[model samples]
Target: MRITLSDLNTKDLATLVQRTITTSDLGKYAVISNHPLLSELKKVYTEYDAVYTKSTYSGKGTDVASADRDRDVSFRALKNFLDGYRKMPSLSNYQFAEDLYQIFKLYDLSLDKMSYSSQTAQMKKLIEDLEKPENIQKLNALSLLPAFNEMKSKQDVFEQIFAEQAGANANLRNMKSASSIRKDLEKALRSYINFITVMKDVTGWELFYADINELVKAAKNSTVADHEKK
Candidate 1:
C-alpha cells in the first residue's frame, strides 16, 4: 500500500519521527567516505590530531613512543567522533528525510543533560505551547528541531492534506474497527521502512547506516501475529 505523509495521523507521525530521531546516531555521518562535511571535518581533525600526536612524541623513549602512538591513534579516533557533535548539520531549509532526521537526532542530543522527568516535562510544555495558533506561526518562521518542530509548524498543513484528520475533538470521526486500524498501522510502518531505503544513500551519518539497515530488514521480515489471552 502506498503511504504518503497524509496517511499518518499527526500524533502518530510525531511519535514515529520522535522515536526514530532520538535513536539515530548523528556522529557516524561524518565518517561516510564521500560526504563533504566529513571531508571538511577530516582536514580540521587531522591537524588537531597531528598537534596532539607530536606532544606524545616529545622526549619519549622508543618503548614509550610506541605505546603513546597507539594511545594517540585511539585518542584521535575519539576526537573525530566527538567532532561530529560540534559540526552538526544545520536544519534550515531541510527538504529531505535524511536531513530532517539528522536535525532531530542532534536536537535530542542537546537534551542529554536533563533528567528524564525534566525532559518529559519540557516536551509536554513544548507541545502545549505549540498548540496555540501564534506559537505555530513562530515555529514555522523560526528554524526549529525537525520532527518536533515540524509537527507543530505543519499542523495546518496536515489538516489540509488529510480530509478526515483525527483530532481531540472531531465530532464526525472516520471511525475504523480495531482490525482495520491495526492493518493501517502495519501498512504505515511498512511504508516508513521502504521510504528509509529510498533515502539511505545519504551521507554524513554513516554511524546510523547499520542501524537503519537492520531496521529495514526487521521491518520487511516482520509478520503480524495474534497475542494469546490469559
Candidate 2:
C-alpha cells in the first residue's frame, strides 16, 4: 500500500502536496530542495497508507475504510511530492502570473454580463406575472415593491466597480512615462465623468453633480498636462 513519490506524475504530485500543505498549519519552506512543509505532508501520507494496509489485512480487501484510506494516502503523498517540485527554484515563472490574471479578469467580466442578463430576465418575468389583476394585488399586499429597487441598487454598484476597474486598466495601457501615466489617470477620471453625464439621462439629478468640466479642471493642474500643452 506504500506509494513512493517516484511513482506519481509530476503535476499530480505537486497538486496533492500543495493542497495538503495549504490546509495544514506549516511555516514557509526555507530551502527549496528540503521543503519542510512538503516533507511533513509526505510523512503524514505515508503513515496514513501504513495504517490502511494494516487495517485491510494485507490487500485481502476487508472493508470500505481500508480502501478509502489507501486511496486518500496515495493521493496526498503524490500531491506533496508535486508541491515540493513546484517550490523548486526552476519552476517560478512570471508569465504564468500574467496569464492567470488575464484569465480571471475575462471570467469576472463574463460572470458580470451573465448576472445582468439574468436580473433583466427576472424583472421581465415579474412584470409579466404582475399583469394579472390578482397577482398585482397580491404583489402590492406582500410589499414586493422594493424587489426591483434592490436589484437596481445592486446592478448600479456592480456597474460602478466594473467601470472603475476598466478605466484604471485603460489608463495603465496608455501610460508611456510617469508624466503620461498622470495624464492617462486624469483622462480616466474625465471618462468617468462623461459616463455619469450619459447616466444622467436615465438617472437624472441622481448623478447630476458628476461633471466632466470638473475633471477637465483637475487635468489642467497636472504636470503632464502642462508639458503636453507646451
Candidate 3:
C-alpha cells in the first residue's frame, strides 16, 4: 500500500490508476461512489487517460516495453494453463485442454524468446487461428474464454501502443506532457487512498478498500521487482 506513484513510469502509473477506479467496483455502492474524493479521483483519472493518449511520446519507449511485457505474461498464461491442464488426465477438461494445446503447438510462436517485432507478428497470426469457430468452441468448453479474451485484449493494446511509438508526425504542440498530468493524478490518488485507509473499517467501504489496497500492494511489488531487475 506504500507504492511511490512517482517511481512508476507513465504506463504503469496510468494502469494502476485505471484499475483502481474502474476495476475496484468503485461505483457499485452509491454511498461509496458519491464521496467527494471518489469523484475527484475519477476526474483526475479522466484527465490522466486523455493526456496519456495525446502525450504518447512522453513514455520514451517504456510504455511499449510495458505493453510488450504485459502481452508476454498474458500470452503465456493461456499457453501454460492449457499445457498444465492437459496433464491432468483424470479431469473432465483434459481433453479440451489437449485440443487447445495442439492449436498452440501448431503455431510454435515461442513468444517469450522472440524479439518484439517478431513476437507481435506471430501473435497476430496465432490470435487469428484462435478465432476459428472450432478453436473458439474448444476454448469455451474448457472455461478458457476469459483468459483468451484477456490475452487478446493485451495484444491489441500492445499493437496500438506500438503503432503510436513511431508517430513522429503527431501534433503534440498543445498537448501536456504525460508526466505533468500524472503528477496531478498522483496527488488525487494519494488523497483518495488516504480517505479509504481511514474509512476501511466502516461497513459499506470495506470491499473497495480491500480491492484498492491489493492493487496498490501489487503495484508496489511490481516496482520493487522492476528495480531488482535493473
Candidate 4:
C-alpha cells in the first residue's frame, strides 16, 4: 500500500495521476467522485499537463526539453543494451560490447544534473568519442551503430532548437514550471489519499481506497520497471 511518489520522474508522475483518475471513474466510487479533493486533483493535473505540452518557447519552435529527453533516452538505451549484451558469452560479438561499454565509463554519468547548455556540450563530446573509428568498429560488431546514430540525431535536434530560441527565451516572461505545478497536483492527490485512509471504514469508502491503492502500487511498479530497463 505504500508508494514513494516523490521518487517518480515527470513522465511517470503524470501517468500515476492519470491512471488514478481513470481507476476512480472505472469503479464508479461515489466517495471519490463526490470529493472536493478529486476536483482539485483534476484541475491541477490539467494545468501541469498543459504546461509541458505547450513548450516554454512563446512562438512556434520545437520543445528543447522534449528533444533533450529523447537524447537522454537514446543514450541510456545504448548503455543498457551494452550492459546486457556484454554479459552474454554465447554471442560472438560480446567482446565488442565489453570494449565499447568501457568508453561510456570514461565520462560523467549524471547528464541530467548539468545545466541545459552544459548538457548539450557534454553530449556533443560524448558523441564525438563514440564516433571515433575504433569505437565505430566495435559498435558495428555489436550492431549498435544505429543506436549511436539515433542518439546523435536527438542531440543535434536539441542543439538546433535551443540555439534558435536562445534570444527569444530571454524576452519571454517567467512562467510556472512543470515541476512546480506537479507539486501542487501531488498535494491534491495526497489529500485525497489521506481522506480515504481515514474514512475507509465508513460504509462505501473501503472500495475507493482499494482501487486507488492498487493504482498507486501499479505506478510504483512501473517506475521500477523503467529504471531496470534503462
Each candidate's clash count = 5, 7, 0, 0
Residues 152-179, model 2: lDDT tens digits: 4444444455455556556544434433
Model 4 scores what on Cα lDDT? 0.80
Off by over 4 Å in 4: 59-172
Taking all chains together, each candidate's TM-score versus the true structure is: 0.22, 0.21, 0.48, 0.49
Sorting all predicted structures by lDDT, with the top scorer first, yields: 3, 4, 1, 2
Output the number of the lDDT-best candidate.
3
User: Candidate 1 at residue 65, lDDT?
Assistant: 35
Worst 10 residues of 4 by lDDT: 53-62
Put down candidate 1 lDDT per residue, 1-230, tens digits, no spaces: 12343344434433443444434435444343354433333343333333322322123234333433343343233223334433544743323333323333444533324543443344345456444675444434443334344433343333333323223114222333333444444444444445445556676434465565654333323311111211
Better of 1 and 4 by TM-score: 4
Instruction: Flag regions of model 3 displaced more than 4 Å.
Output: 1-59, 169-230
Q: What is the C-alpha lDDT profile of model 3 across 114-179, one tens digit per residue?
A: 887889878888899899998899899888899999999999999888788766425464566777
Name the lDDT value of residue 100 in candidate 1.
28
1-230 per-residue lDDT for model 4 (tens digits): 56677788888888888988787777477666646777788889998887756555566254877777888899889988988999998989898888877777665566755778888777788888988898899998888889888998988888888876776665443656777887887788888777778887899988878887888888888888988999
